[model samples]
Target: MQDGSDWYGAATATFGDRVAGAREALGMTQPELAERLGVRIKTVRGWENDTAEPRANKLQMLSGILGVSLTWLLNGEGDGLDQPAGEAGARLPEIRTLLSELRDIRADVDNAAERLARMENRLIEALTEGRVE
Candidate 1:
């Protein structure tokens, strides 16, 4: 957060941007966030991907839990988080490197989830065909 920027500002950031940035700023993993929200990890992943949205109740909870205003999360209008202040210049490269690694890890997680779903579907089909005990 030492980059001296509104990493999740309203300018052109989407809801996903706010959610993911806030989560990372807080050092919360996706599974941790899901547990706190009483939802599946997939739900959190979808939010991060901008592929789905939470219901109103979940939305309220999300804002509260994430320590960000609802308006900011929705349309980036109200209060949003600031990066943690510190010596940034020296760590800028490291932060960028870690962020890149995090993205790659997230992609792998998403891929694994999709593969798991496919495997589950295959098992279900096998059961339906009376091929599995």
Candidate 2:
């Protein structure tokens, strides 16, 4: 935001440029994104040109839908937003280990849910057949 550029304007330009770059990298056209966002092609072009700003909800949706990070859009920092360093390196092996554990826990929860559903069906069948004992 230095060099006499308006801070807000600079921010908008950064966001818009990154948005367009990310979209192009993903091989999406303005019309394609407009369809995904339920916006007009003009609206998408306005965002790319910094002519207009998106609402807060749209911004969040854009981040998710574009597969980038809000921080990357606003500040142009990190590895293309939502991708911080040390996420997959030995420097943060503990964090990676913890992430693996979390995934395992999630899998366990899914397995438990499936087992519970099967158990419920068995219980219902037993009750319907008067085999409660």
Best-matching candidate per TM-score: 1
TM-scores, all models, native as reference: 0.67, 0.50
Model 2 ranges with Cα > 4 A deviation: 1-13, 79-133
lDDT of 1 by residue, 1-133 (tens): 1221354455545687789878887899999999999999989988887768999999999998888888888876667776445775446557756765665688688889899999999999888999655
TM-score (C-alpha) between model 2 and the true structure: 0.50
Backbone Cα, N, C clashes tallied per candidate: 0, 0
CA error at residue 121 for candidate 2, angstroms: 66
Mind giving the per-residue lDDT tens digits that candidate 2 earns over 1-133?
1121221123323566677767876899989998998898777866776557898888888878877667666667533522223533333446545644654565566567779999999999888899654
- For candidate 2, the per-residue lDDT at 104 reads 58
Worst window of 10 by summed lDDT in candidate 2: 1-10
